[model samples]
Target: MPIISVTVGVALLLVLMMVFKLNAFVSLLIVGLFVGVLEGMSPLEAMESVEKGLGGTLGHLTIIIIFGAILGKLMTDSGGAQRIATTLIHSFGEKRVQSAAVITAAIVGIALFFETGVVVLIPLVFTIATAARVPVLYIGMPVIAALITMHGFVPPHPGPTAVASVFGANIGLTMILGIIIAIPAFILGGPVYTKFFKKESLEIEIPKGLFNPKEFKEEELPKFGISLFTALLPVILIALQTIVQIVAPESPIAPVTNFIGDANVALLISVLVAIFTFGLNLGKKMPEIMQSLSEAVSGIALILLIIAAGGAFKQVLIDSHIDKYISDIMAGSTLSPLILTWLIAAILRIAVGSATVAGMTAAGIAAPLVAATGASPELMVLAAGAGSVTFSHVNDAGFWIYKEYFNLTIGQTIKTWSVMVTIISIVGLAGVLILDMFI
Candidate 1:
């Protein structure tokens, strides 16, 4: 089959799944089979490829994502996120809730994965918006926007990490660029946009039992300072490792860099801290602590499954040589890898309704092109991350979450959340392109 035919077929398959409401996992599996057969593989070979792809990809990411989800759930359920938000809001003052929302979201994003972060913070967002007598969108957009920015651009989060790994980017450089891009993107998509949304005055009843404010009774809640430190410990350690490696290449810290700042190590430390701060110190029993941990991890089952399926889809694309063919075709074009990465990611994101999938698939397809052209791996990764976050629609769970939570019509959700996401995507791509010029 012609490469164009394969591309169109794959595109159509995605659209049908997303638009016609087919299951994404099933769609991906079917698309993979179709692509494999069309590419001349035998039926048996295609089925084997599906299994191999799913197993291999899940093998790499399952533990990391599952653990990350658990850590996030612990923090959230234990009121750690509330501690951060309330403290920040109080410190920033009511007039600057927008700024506070953005900061909290960024911090939470660094600590938690995208969906986990959203789930954790949405309650506090509602509380704050209510107290301020503003539309929920006013508060919600800034927080979610900040989370999206960090999830796309920062490390320790799976999207950027996956992109960095695929592109051979320096984790340190990617982190640096991610922060730089994140600040501006957050401001644009967040506080600034919040002002506009506030004017619309959409009311949403705060969900009951979202967070038990009583849970934070003076003696029950961890000290705000301790909770903040515990929340940030992993990110701080990872950033320290990245900085040391970049600045002191031969330093003694080199040996321990991976050990101290590795995802597993950082998360382990956070989990331990959570036990002490939220469980032991809070007078909870050992059994309760264990239950909390298990519950937190279990909440992430759907996220893990979706991510695993995405990985499987990516592997299938690789096995079919579609990635290589696309790389070859784009290699001769004048399009910069940065722009190309973003565009491909955006297209896939809009088509598939999963930013992680879009990022992973785009990175896989663009990796070969980056190698062929000697493009900066860091820029390529950022571009792919940016692209993966373009336009959100009804197909995207985030879109519906925002719409229902904020009580917005679909139009309003698009006008606000969708627009903010598009801005993040575009600004992120621009940031990568500008950085490319200098680096």
Candidate 2:
């Protein structure tokens, strides 16, 4: 029942997950039970703890994740994603493809979940890279970096969303801080990194039956302006809600702010706008649009499950008292809570292979410290988020996705995407720490 033994047990459990290729939910559940038993709970109590942890955590955020997935699917399948990418490319010009790729990924990532954003853009990336005579990694790295940044730091995208929920931080403040850190992370980790790591030009082929680059006949494609608006509507709505809550908390609009600025409502508005701009106005039948939405949702089922399992795993960590133990240890140390959050998240991210899990676990463990120190909860959230996304390796799905999509060998993925994620984590942590000084 020693803390050292408990720490070693948790570490070994994560190793087992990698070695046995165990499902993260099951692995964490087993680990939780073991930790609980070691901490002096009966076996029955340990089992019950798992159930309580999963149920407690999932109750609040599951619906938000499901709705977010559905919205992403709708946007991806209706060609709204394509419209956004094509417009950005034209507006930014070939020389600025890195900037365009980063912006597109960040915007779409905010609208869609991470996996959905990558799947929707992979084909477009191939087409653009071919036309520009550049290495696909030149384009892929920037885009994937942006998606990773948004997925980790932005709201309503599972990682930060779950962190905000766990810590009881203001969702609006989290969203604002997420954006403030995201811009610099994208620039440092995206375009600048892409410039240095540009790879050899190699031809790549899109899979057959995937949407062709030319499928949208010029006449049927929505206007660039309309497509841009559709892509940005949700972000604007959510930002407005956050701004109003912060700047005009006593104003008349504050009472109904949740109704207008709720993440679900904001996304629902975007869905309606997408139906009009990309579906109805484009002459698509309602049935066809509905079909696209259904398929899009189906495509993201695996991702949703992974995220849910991550949530379940996090709940176990909390229930097992592992989080409290770590928080207590950090509280007794000289290290700042901000730095401790980042370090814990970064370590777990490397061990567990999922940024979402790392972020949630770190936040859960760090929440008590934030309370004890009376530090800004917003900064704690940002530090945890940054730490969660610090590194990528063969075990991480995002790393493999980047490797396969860009035809990079493992070494190249390490050099490019892996390094980019590390930079983002460090830069994001620095931003949070600096803000900690002021706040």
Candidate 1 residue spans exceeding 4 A from truth: 133-135, 170-173, 196-215
Please report how far candidate 1 places residue 227 from its true position, in Å. 1.6
Range of the 10 consecutive residues with the lowest summed lDDT in candidate 2: 197-206
lDDT, candidate 2, equals 0.75
lDDT of each: 0.76, 0.75
TM-score, candidate 2, is 0.89
lDDT of 1 by residue, 1-439 (tens): 4466457656866776767887766766777677777877788887888888778766766665666666676677677777888889999998888788888898878768777777678877887888987777778888889998898888767788767766777665687789898888878877776666447554556665544443466555567887788777877766777777778968987769757776667667777877887677877788888887788677766655555555565666667787788777776888787887899889989988888778876776677777667799988888998998899998788888777656677887888889999999888888888888898
Per-residue lDDT tens digits for candidate 2, residues 362-420, read 77557778666677887788888999889889879888877776666787679887899
Which one is best on TM-score? Answer: 1
Best by lDDT: 1
